[model samples]
Target: MNKRIQILSFLFLGLSQIVFSQIKEEKLILDKKREPEVKKIEKKKTSVETIKNYPPEEKSANPVTYDITNVPAVSDFKTSTIQGQDISPNFNTDYQNNYVRFGMGNFGKILGDAHISTVLESKMEVGADVHYLSTTGLKKEYDWNSNQSNATIGAFLNNYGEKGKLNLEANYGLQDYNYYGIYALQPTSDTDLKQKTNRFTINGNYDFYSNEILNDVRLQTSFLSDHFSANENQGAITVNLSKHRLFAGNDFKMNTDLGVKLETLKTDFALLNQNKSSFFNAALLPEISFYKGESYLKIGANINFLNSRNESLILPQDKKSEIIWSPNVEVLFAPQDEFRFYAGVDGGLKLNSYAELLTENPFLVSDIELRPTNTKYHLYIGLKGDIDENLKYDFSAGYSKINDMQFFQANSIFDDVYTLNRSAYNFANTYSTIYDNGNLSEVKGSLQFFPLQNLDLSAELLFQKYQLDNLDEVFNKPLLQATLGAKYSMLNEKLNFGFKGIFVSDRTTNSFEISPNNISVPTAYVSTENRNKKVGGYADLNLSAEYKINKNFSIFALGNNLLNVNYQTFNGYKVIGAQITGGVKISF
Candidate 1:
């Protein structure tokens, strides 16, 4: 046919130029998506005139800062409010063998407390305590190893005002003691059988109060320092005033106080460089008290004056003056709420002078010893009662009289050497020394019973008497003591058991002679004898137990001389028969 219609008219003219090149590649991908939406609508109309001619750097989102040097500096930082007032240290140690009865002792304890506070106010506190003790053997010629040490430090100040109040206190202390000696003369010699003692102390206090005076009054001041190695270094100063009142009988009330005290003492022993002494004391005391309903009354008096000086040239370097009188009275009687009654009386007077300085550049004097100035009296009575709710009773009695009483008589060519002016007069025993007079008396009683309610029962009694003017040749008899005890608590109270017993009696007198020629010659040509002995009454029993397995744990068991009887209560000292110990404790 016409060449197949001219090849279908060039295949419809190449499909009309391929449909116009597929509509120009779909309008060039719709003009690249409308040319980025027509350049984002011409960049939103040219950013609306540069955001309407610029004005908006106000973009804080909250910020005000100083670089702080690029912030990052913490070299070991620690804080818990500065470690909660920092001060934590404590250690303790204790060991025992054959425990109580003051034997076989070993202990060490340490403690500390510190405080400081402030954010806007003030406060400071400091504290310390340390102690050590030891005893292991020997106790007659000494040698039982004894040691003691003590230390204390304190400081306090507080002020956080509103009205008015102030307090400041300071304290310091040190104590040391050592003793060891056990005869045989030199059993591993500790040269001259060592003995040492030391002590030092300081104290201060100040107090003041004011309600603008009259409606409130209080004032105080105090200072004290004491040091003793053997005998003295003391000082004191005190002053106080107080007043409180409500008088027109609203059950009557009155309280008053007045005081003054000044004291000084310095005895320089400093290793026996030879005796030295000094003293100055001044005192005034006034007190009054009265309270109603349950009754109370008190009165006090003390007047003192003393100026003394002694610097032995072997005794007399006199500068002595003295006047001392003390008086006191107190009474309290409770009419109900479990009965009570008390009574008291005290009296005193003392005057002194003694001069005897031994050896130093041909200096010797002994006869200025007029020390028979005296007055001392004491009488006291007491009673306490409770009868119904679990029984209790107490009774006491005392009587004392000492008038020019001082005794010492020993001089038979130094009765075995050991003298430090035993009331000097040794122109080679100018008719052997003599002085005698004495008195002392006492009585005590107690009884308590719970009977049940965790049971506890107690009984105690003591009586003492000593009166000598030649107690048949020099005293040693008259002291009776008794004690009985019981206690029990079972398991619910976490177990606790106790028992105690004590009873004693003694009587002794001795005088002996039988010498061939140890010459002190003639006691009617020797052969003198007088001896009496009755020392056979002693009993002691003690048992203790405690256990609490909770609340920081606990366990304690002790038995002392529980029947292992074998006695000797001083003559050569020997007592320590039975022993048992158990211990465990934890606390926090």
Candidate 2:
């Protein structure tokens, strides 16, 4: 019995020692965690790896809808320079094999569009499209006869092979408009106010899918003419090649681009007689790019040759030839995954084609001169990043020096005999292109927010300032611009709503100088009196809604200029007032 008691006592003492040791170890661990040194280390590493590996957010599935009516609102000008192509409305619709839509609104406005595509084989496809829009005269009192219409037809083919892809497209368009800016002056009749334009274009491209050298080739041709006997033809070809090699213990991509462009213009004026001009341009661009970790750098240069010839009997005889060299450099640095910084310096030559000018202002003088714009240098810096999974932001600033920058002014300033004898567009209703050396500074910012899975909101702002060498103001260029848009999807993605708003600050332009003697007469008499005019600021609001009835059919309604402000895009051309249209969409 005594031996059993001793064994039990020994087992109890061992158990007590094990329990005490465990408690002491746990207390030590808690005390260490409370220390300032340990707390700092824990905070530094919290979620660091998780954020570095976070995946990019998925893109929105719902498509953005566009305005059905083709209103020439001043809000359309988003920047100092107008860019992008005037594509048919059919190409802007939702992705479908076959689509059709039609709508109508006030001021005798009409919209019609259709697109058809079919797959002939596993690697071949063909498609065609047609678009039309028109509107009658504005308010009756204006007596402007501001009739306008646009029609276009296009066809395309695509072929895909194992190693390359080929694409071909052709398009023809007709535009009819009236020079109704006669409100600024007195007119006896609207006899010579109508204008018609015709354009044809063809484009072809081939892209190689390979790990080797050659990349792609492209060719384009276009012809444009108007009822006033003005015609233009243009053509261009481009080739791209690239290779990857190891240089200085780093992998680098060397790229080369070769291009050539030709343009010919012919114009017939009753007073100035016939004029013909030709322009030729050639360019070679070479670039090298290298990447290390999260940093990327590109160094490049552009070498160009420009030539122009004027073969005219009545107009001034002139010729020009020159060679231009410009530098190109770009850098991108990303210290972490959430932020990126980019900087670049670039420049190029911009051909001032008749078609391009007409797209900006339809009422252009037939005898206006053509010149090429050269950008000496452009320096820019930008930052882009994400605030969180639901918000993204981009901000940028830039400065540029430009030679032969184009501006528009009243034709009455010409003060030639043609102004007195011309039958149409002779008054202050027409515009002519002028050039000057200038410097531009700009700042821009944008934000995109997706608070919910089916909701999207965006806002953008731009500010621009210009300094001209000779000109008084940046003609018809806005100083400040803003755009806001929102989209929502609901009801199992069957119903959608969209809203858009545009705002622009005051724009300055040259106007007919008022007579110092207070005598009201034709502006042609006082041609030397040049004065500045301010076009008032304006805002445009648009709303759209769509409801799907089934898989193949949907109904939509669009409202434009909801604020009912009749603002002028040009000096005297005013757009239509508030208008609404409803249409049906079909897809097959």
Candidate 3:
């Protein structure tokens, strides 16, 4: 008819130009995720990866939930606030490997704890623990009515074999004290004026990831003893070995660390004090790293080998060997996602052990001496993120130069000859350990506030400047410090409440001559013993409450130094007032 209607109008304009154009057929996706046995099982080996492996929020800066209905309160268990924010307590309480607690207080204080653990299904785990603390009312005098006791026993082992992980630890401890800060004209009081200690520890570690460059090995050993009333004794032994090297991903990264440490110190007072101090330490750290996006850099060095001795200073220049170098750098800059900036230069070699300085002063002075404290320079800068996620912050600035730098003096101040030609110094009871050549400058700040969602608030501040060499005071060092804390949680999580406050400032000691007749002893004032003595300053308050009563039991109460402010953390020492502890914890 017109050539078959022009071929049906050219097949309807070729199906209307393929239905008006814009493609529309999809279905040919064949990407078995790069098949080939999944790229051969991701190339097998992985363990020496210098940088990568931190999925748990980069390994916990916080944020973990095991969600037991959002368990958070236990007075904010696992505490870490004051703005550092560690707060992790989603408590299923470690599946109750076992637990126990007991308590007593009011000067004759006593507390005890117990534990047990197990986990074997080839993930081998085992544990043990025991702890106790004691106190008997005191107020007669070396420094003011004192009695103390401490104990501990611990054991652990964890293994996750199949060519890797293994860890073990052991511990033992005991302590007892009573010196009574004399000088109402000596004489001696009770329990023959005591002080006793004993400790033991062992540690082991192994981490083999055989492929991809992994390695980690460690071992440690320790022993300690301290006995004194007069006929003093101080002892120590430590051994350490370490090795680490692992590198994996993040563009370029490398790591190597090697270590060895052996220490020994033994001293006996009287007979012109016997001596023995030996140290042989070695360390080498190598590092290089770079990370893209959000930036990060790490470059390192910290090589050292020291051999020091004193079998009583038979002089060979007093026997000491040295070779040290420090500079371990770090950097980080986070473009966004809340913020981050960090900078660092760190140096090491601390090890001033005698059970770590009697566990931070159990009223030292049993002819104690041990050395190996050298920071040799440190500089730091920091700023941490989080403005959302309920607020978080950290700020820091630091500078340090220490060579020995350890101080705690106030002993041998006055006795025979008022302590000698205007030298029998007199500050307070006792505590001795000095090694100064210090320099430190610091500034710190922190804050955290969680509007709600159970509430939490934290605060911290510190400012300091201390310098000493031929000493010009750096004694108890506290140039300003602060803390504020709070925690809350209710019903659902089963109750928890807490509060804390602390502040300190102005500290300088030559044993505080501070006289206005000692300002009625409310932290001391006055000043002058040729300079630097103004202990003063104090404020402290604390409280806590807990309930939990179900899922494994809990009940707690603690109230310490509740503004019964009578400070003196050394220097005629006298603190501990207004205290209460109530406890009950059971999970089996």
Which one wins on TM-score? 2
Model 1: per-residue lDDT, tens digit, 1-588? 466447645844874474345434432211110000000000010000011111112211112331211111101111011001001011011111111111121122122212222222243322222222222323333443333333334343434234433334344434332222111112232322222233344444433423122222222222221222334456666666656453426565666666677766655442212455666767676777676765668787766776778664466667878777666667878685356787876655443322111101001112222233343556678776666556667677877666554422211222333222222222122111123556667787777765455555678777877675554543234388777776655545566666666777774533233333345542222234444534466666666665667755556655554554545442222344445545554433
Ranking by lDDT: 2, 3, 1
Report the candidate with higher lDDT, 1 versus 3: 3
Clashing pairs in 2: none
Model 2 lDDT per residue over 333-408, tens place: 8675457788999988877887878888888876676777888889999987664455667788999999998888
Tens digits of per-residue lDDT for model 3, 1-588: 466447545844763364224113322232211111101000111111112232223222234432111111122111110111111122321224465766666766666666676777876777677777676634532433366667777777767576666777787877766555443233324324556777777777666644224345666666666664222222323322222224435443334333334434433432124445666666666666565555667787777777776654332326778888888888988776467888898888766765676566666665556677888879999877765566677787999998888877765433223321121113245566889777889998877765555555678888988777787667777888988876655565566666666788868766533333333544323333434666787766666566778879877766665554446665555655656768787767
Pairs of residues at least 3 apart in sequence or in different chains that clash in candidate 1: 137-144, 143-181, 314-356, 314-357, 314-358, 315-356, 315-357
Model-by-model lDDT, in order?
A: 0.42, 0.64, 0.57
Task: Name the runs in model 2 displaced over 4 angstroms.
Answer: 1-95, 188-190, 245-275, 311-315, 386-389, 413-422, 513-528
- Candidate 2 deviates by what RMSD? 18.9
What value does the lDDT take at residue 546 in candidate 2? 70
Model 1 CA RMSD to the hidden true structure, in angstroms: 39.6
